[model samples]
Target: MKNVGVDGSTTLKVYESRGGYVAARKALAMDTNAVVEEVKKANLRGRGGAGFPAGVKWGFLPKDRTTTLLCVNADESEPPTFCNRVLMEHDPHQLIEGTIIAAYATRSQVAYIYMRGEFHEQFHVLQKAIDEAYEAGYLGKKVLGTDYALECYIHRGAGAYVCGEETGLIESLEGKRGQPRIKPPFPAIEGLFRRPTVVNNVETLSCLPHIMERGADWFTGIGPPHSAGPKLFCVSGPVNKPGCYEAAMDITVRELIERDDMGGGMLSGRKVKAVFPGGLSMGVLTVDELDMKMDFEDPRNYSLLGLGTAAAVVVDDATDIRLVLRNVARFYGTESCGQCTQCREGTSWMQRIAQRIESGAGRMEDLDLLLETARNMGMMPGLSICGLSDGATYPIETIVKKFRPELEAAIRSQPAGQVEAVLQAAN
Candidate 1:
């Protein structure tokens, strides 16, 4: 990422000089099935929170379909997930080349980079790169003198967090409100413009160039089995040096936070209290659990939602988990699309309960009520339209469950009259 500075590295000449676009050219020359097979063998999973195998997703496209579309999800709206944005800013050509390779593999004729509208700087950077690619025969009809042709465009989103959801992104791209559509007819079957579409994250696509250049075996050998390859993790919050760092997936959560070259340990000379191994969607892990690996499966072992976006948010010992819960609850509550009653109403309730608790007005039963509300709004189908509500539930549920004693102590310390006023205010 340092290669990108005020001097600029956003041109085709700088990119090609660094052996860029070669992978896209090579991919364009191979059979589409061959490219897809390589990616599948490499086991590249989506980095956009879902952890779905990218190659497997591509394989789901109906072979009979004529207009397969590839949508590069550049909407990095999730809190503390600047990994995608960083990649796009530092290496726009890498993403562009990967987009072309993915489009070729999916037999997609048209590609759209569904970018977050708030990323005005990145939008212009990518736009300049795309124009350079087109002028140099890397995009547009007959790319690189081959009969294969592809058209790419950028569609900016209106800064909706729901748009980070693939289906929601598709809707936004189609000039509709950013709301997730019901599944069963997944994006691979019916997506943007009602055509077969494959939505992939910017980081996921950015890996394609290196995967093609070095071969699938090399890619698979980078980390532990099932979670191979290098991953970009955005480490933020209370750390001496919180930023994006790329490492093998096998790196433990502790290493990522304490390593001098990574997060550089906690600020204020404080000890670690907890860490969100993934982004906000994943539940927080106590300092004792820091030894846990930062893989797709390890998070499940810690009883967290899957490694969603692998952006580790660290909290120092001085921080209160109640404040954490309240902050997260407010984020989800504000971002809820209101398409589902359970999510809309449940998130609001969770926010109120968390705020009340943080405000020293929590009742003893409020903890049970919080857990009950989370259970009711679980990620299970028929509960919510999308995973937003489920993401909202993780922090509140996990924090309350894991740190009940601390919360209980806080509640007990509040004056009885103050607590009564809180109840009256709610009523």
Candidate 2:
């Protein structure tokens, strides 16, 4: 069993011993355009909630454009998702090699690793690795004695979830408030100082080295068709063994939970209540659908759940759905940059309603009002700066739709003892 968090251990020597930099060497030997074509063939999608195809994004850079940039989104602020942290700390060079290959494919001259400010330890680890690469001649001008010239730098973000967004990150990097920019001139066309840029998540880039090292067919064949390659599943909450697990895409929630190799079921033999296959943004799945596989298409087709970043968060029978929704609502509300009227006001309104309901101060009609407000907030595309507006509204809509009985029960019972119990258990 090879350790998955190999990059986190600051064992760059060990990483090289495990065939780490082979992909960069191979990529340098091939034509840049061919590398992009190979990535396209692999069908590698973005792991940063968007699920956009990575190669297609790389191909979007204008051929005539100069001064292209590749920005790695390592700001994993999505609650309960820790896959990127493991990759950065365990296998820094894997990301470095992947970033170089991506830059080569896009003909970018420079790259930046925009990381979360709280990841101080991992940031230092990556910074050390970048220095090692530059010293070893893997980075900087004319790398590996080839005509290609590139450099990689690390930029720390000031702990804003909105900065996880591509355009918001660009603004934050420029020392401004983190607010997402409207698309039309998408990041691919104009990004990072108004030049052509391609923003990819850490996991999306980490897999690139292997994709180029082994071939697009080999990379695509690792996981299920369409949803190709190994995914790092971040399992947390009430599970016996809560941590990250790298496995094929076809593994179901039942297998992941019950199997000893993964989280090994709920702690203390508790009943599974609900599962968020992707993160807070994705719709929740009831216990009845526990057998649903954690793949791109399976959840989409069977459970109506979006596969954003392939992040799996499990909630047990002891957990209260209303309580969880309240916390989730507060996160969105607090993080809303207040750029758009709907998101600015809607997030605050949703949080207040959820809190009232959770605290037993809410009226029966408040449910309908919350749902209507959420629907109204979601009316426009690219509404509040980034998807913060959409992200906040999604869980509210999903919780109301999927757990109406629970909401109704909470409202009807209104017992002080039970409310206190739910509140205590939630914390």
Candidate 3:
């Protein structure tokens, strides 16, 4: 965020003037194991919704493998989440430099940045930065004058939200359908053409250069011990100043919404009705639950699927909760790869039921049915290939459970014809 909005920040020359690539150069000179160990001590968690420790994930690779690949997941697919694009457009070199260091540390001979097809502008900017790094000997054979050879390329995804899953990304990279595979032989063991692979998102990789430049202990000291470090948060939906922000994980959901420098409070001074605290997938936080911390662990306490992407979408009292439920349900239904029957039918069923409820054609029993369907959708034992269906579950489950009265009232009062006026007033 420091380089954001600065003139020529995306250019190699300007980035070099600010001592960019210093960490990559330093990392190139250190032992690979040492680099991994330093990151482990930093407690840096993946920013790609999972919040898994990046260093621990790296250590999962087999020691005997000769060829390893590092993938940068630039597919920012979570709804209303575009913070990853901010780093790509404003400070691409930081992400590129971090990619170089991460690939080297993971002993990856090749690296690919899996970008979403929608990111036309970010793709060009990041590609330009990669070209500059290659010309500077910071990438390609003999990185930074060291013996470490790394080849990094940008691979464009065909707009599949499920590709945000690592296995799905790998399958797409292999020229196959973008769908996730089962675990046990995770990406660390058999990934990307059946070789050991590491997949970290743009924000997670971007933290690598910083960890290399500054000691790991410095990162560990930032926030909570388990989920420490600088965090990028995007606040949206009717906030006075909705935008991408960077801060330590110590910030609360309420602060992220009401902070003058961040969200600047809700628009038109409306009270907050609810918030999708961690994108649409993690779960919803009612107005009374706004005090929840944005760290990776706290969301779990509130039945969220972890601090997913740290992108918070606020819902003011003016909006209807059923609309949110229907929208997300429809999204997961449309986006599900139809790989798993439960996920495929489950998302569609939830979407249809939500639409019915919103249209005032729902029965009283429909609320409980929605809850049951969502609870068992993606989390069934040995059923779901990935957590995509689970993503659909949390938002629907939370909204129905936490705000049942609101949804129930809408169901009973909305007489199908009144649905039009509700939509019109919202618009």
Report the number of the highest-TM-score candidate.
Answer: 1
| Alpha-carbon RMSD, candidate 3 | 3.4
Clashing pairs in 2: 6-90, 7-89, 7-90, 7-91, 8-89, 8-90, 257-265
Q: Candidate 1, residues 19-89: lDDT per residue as tens digits?
A: 88888888988999999999999999998999999999999999899999999999998888899888888
In terms of lDDT, which candidate is stronger, 1 or 2? Answer: 1
TM-score of 1: 0.97
* Model 3 Cα lDDT, one tens digit per residue, 257-343: 999999999899899999998889999999989999999889989989889999999988988787888898899989999999889
Of candidate 2, the 10-residue stretch with the lowest lDDT total is 1-10
**Which is better, 1 or 3, measured by lDDT?**
3
Residue 83 of model 1 has an lDDT of 91
Model 2 residue-pair collision total = 7
RMSD of 2: 3.7
From the highest lDDT down, the ranking of the candidates is: 3, 1, 2
What 10-residue stretch in candidate 3 is worst by lDDT? 414-423
Cα deviation in Å at residue 364, candidate 2? 1.5
Provide the TM-score for each candidate, comma-separated. Answer: 0.97, 0.93, 0.96
